[model samples]
Target: MDIDVFATAHRLEWQRLDALIRRRRRLTGPEVDELVELYQRAATHLSTVRSSGQDPALTARLSGLVARGRSAVTGAHASAWGDVSGFFVRTFPAVLYRMRWWWIGSALLSLALGAGIAVWIMADPQVQAAIGPPEEIRAYVEHDFANYYVEHPGASFAAQVWTNNAWVSALALVLGVFGCLPTVYVLAQNAANLGVAGGLMFAHGKGDIFLGLIIPHGLLELTAVFVAAGVGIKLGWTLIAPGPRPRLQALAEEARAAMAVVLGLVVVLFVSGLIEGFVTGWVHITWLRIAIGVAAEALFLAYVFVLGRKAVHEGETGDIAHRPETAPVAG
Candidate 1:
């Protein structure tokens, strides 16, 4: 393979990479460019040597230089706190803003379904009987419904709710790959349960108590769930209709973007869990609790439409910046 000839030809490039690695902190901009160029050349040289049965020592030296050069070019990562702040400020909201309509539709449909079920349960005597006897229904409405929240220690209950809600949101996102059918099933089950509870309460003449306790945390909690389901369903639909991109590529892009929602919803659900645990049962005032829930929901909406819009305008797609993206091409 004339190893010596190749070594003599590329020694200068290898040396440059070594020099750049040694003085990475002091390199001028041009020198930094030169370092990257040399790093690329050194990598090529190593590949050629490996394939051509070159001397082991020469191959090892080039390999070390290329490794060091790669590190110098990429630099270190930002702090953990910086990553967390960036996700909330830019990535999370930007995704929420971009995917707003999908979630909004989900919210409307789920709410309507819930309300319809409630109405059916309230008006149909057969359904009420199937649910249970009138006395049991009244007892549940008067006691068991609200008592469920206070039966456990607040902290423990909050933890349980946080974990359960997080799991459900995560399921919607992960199962979305198979098409949105699974996610829809999960949402339907939840809506049905909510409807039965609301209807039972209303039938027993405890409508105010029902809304007062449920509205506080359920507002934000359910919104987060809706968002999760919406994103999941959208991701699934991407497979069915990938637009201009290939199906696999479209799925990858949507999955990457939707994952941000999963993480963001965890925090949202945690806040809701706190409200459900401490505020719903602990706070005896109906109006004040509902007001707190409304305020939290408002803040979430503002954060998405305002900060999210700004980030989207600035070219953030909720995908991590360093990750490889599909390159744009002219048609």
Candidate 2:
């Protein structure tokens, strides 16, 4: 005479009866009354089961049956973006609030390490000696700046550079799933090269020339790099600290958030590629280049640091946060 079992069984029967009624089927008033009574009984039983610390298998089974019956009556449909917006609204503020330190710290460390390594390589005479004679280094530098594109005469230089930039950006994002180690390595390697090139430009008294060439696009390109690196770090950290969830579940949640960051970075890289291929080489005026570079940097920083932070905060507690949760349930 376990009332819990009786109530659970009745709930299951009531759900089946509700589904039958929804399918344009006829049900007498007494049938509807019976269904309501059963539902109430099940609710009461659930409270008792919860208090007793017993497995609620019967309750879960009833719920599943009810869900299946409803699906049968209404038909399956895909969930809309509007339906899931509440999840993003609730989650982003917490994540952004926690992630600010990681983003800033990683950017500073990467920049400082990259610059330090570059300086060391350029200043050490033995290092230069190991790289071979001055003539060889000069030849390499000239090839990199001027002659590399000449070797591939058929392909459109602009197209090639754009394609290569896109591929590299994508690789950075995809490789981040593997604990972000690969992405970090890629970013570090690129930073090292940039540092060396910058050092060489200064040593040869062509620092101004280098600045004019790189400033226009490098502003966007470098920001893209930092964003990608930050995403990878976020993913890796989730695995390290999963809160109350199991590690695998935590990793999956992190991947979803990291994907959003990657999507944002892709847009950045596309703009950077366009600037690099078309504007950087054509715009030779130092003053114009500086203006464009500074403007672009200001805009990017405003969006990434200021606007992004505000959006996350508003999303968590504003009207936008409730819209998704209140969306019509998919039939």
Candidate 3:
């Protein structure tokens, strides 16, 4: 018998026997043990026949057994949405909670970049000269800043900011599958631009003014970007180090993890957009901006940390509750 034929036949017989046991709908411990023994014997016989390069009949029998086993295994009904709730509660929260460091690090990095650009623009005489007179800068700045709010007084500036955040986040998540290169490049460019803009504003003695305008919506917006970028990096690295699993299998697993991160980000983007569109546009008071910004930041932090922890706990409890229990055997 050919080795492949023998192996296939051996599997088929085991399957058929398994199906028979299930169909009988009643089995004692000894009966189950007997079935197991028969399966082992069949497998052993198939192996021996293959090694001897004989017994085509044995190979055929084994093939039939394998088919039966497959049928038995797949015969049971399964729930369609059994996995989704657990995924959201356990997997999503775990990913977000664990990634807090990435969010904080990215925010600090963005702030540093912004500060560096502010200093550079302030110190550079040539750049300052190129930027032209103070009147030109003031006129351009006033027009750019005032035009939108002036035209649409009822429009939510906070919401627009949040929308921009969602666009950046979606880009990060979708492009992350390609590896971290795209995400890293995008982050770098954003950081550089922020820095340049900050520097220009500070050089013109508008440092406090700029912060007042940006800080209202920036805290959550910036954190979301970093979290999204971190997720992309993680996905890219999974492809690079698949460990014992096949490359494709590893990639699939990483994609699952990335999806959880992205889902949480959608929530973040929605809230951030609301703040940007509504709060930032209508609220010109510094104290009000600070109050609202702090409250928003606190809410996000609580969601990521406290709510995520609770989700993990709930997942563990659910798993224990849902697991099938086996009956005790008679002596």
Candidate 1 residue pairs in backbone clash: none
Over 65-150, each residue of candidate 1 has an lDDT whose tens digit, in order, gives 66667778888556889999999999999999999998898889888999999999989989999999878987898899989989
lDDT per prediction?
A: 0.87, 0.61, 0.65
Each model's Cα RMSD: 6.9, 7.7, 9.9
C-alpha positional error of residue 195 in candidate 1 after TM-score superposition, expressed in Å? 0.6
lDDT (10s digit) by residue, model 2, range 121-220? 6688677666557887776565566344244432365567656766766666567667768878877877787887777665666667667777887877
Candidate 3 lDDT at 265 equals: 77
> After superposing candidate 3, which stretches have Cα over 4 Å from the reference?
1-90, 129-136, 146-162, 309-331
Over the full model, what C-alpha lDDT does candidate 1 score relative to the true structure? 0.87
Model 1: residues with Cα > 4 Å off, grouped in runs: 1-77, 325-331
lDDT of 3 at 224: 83
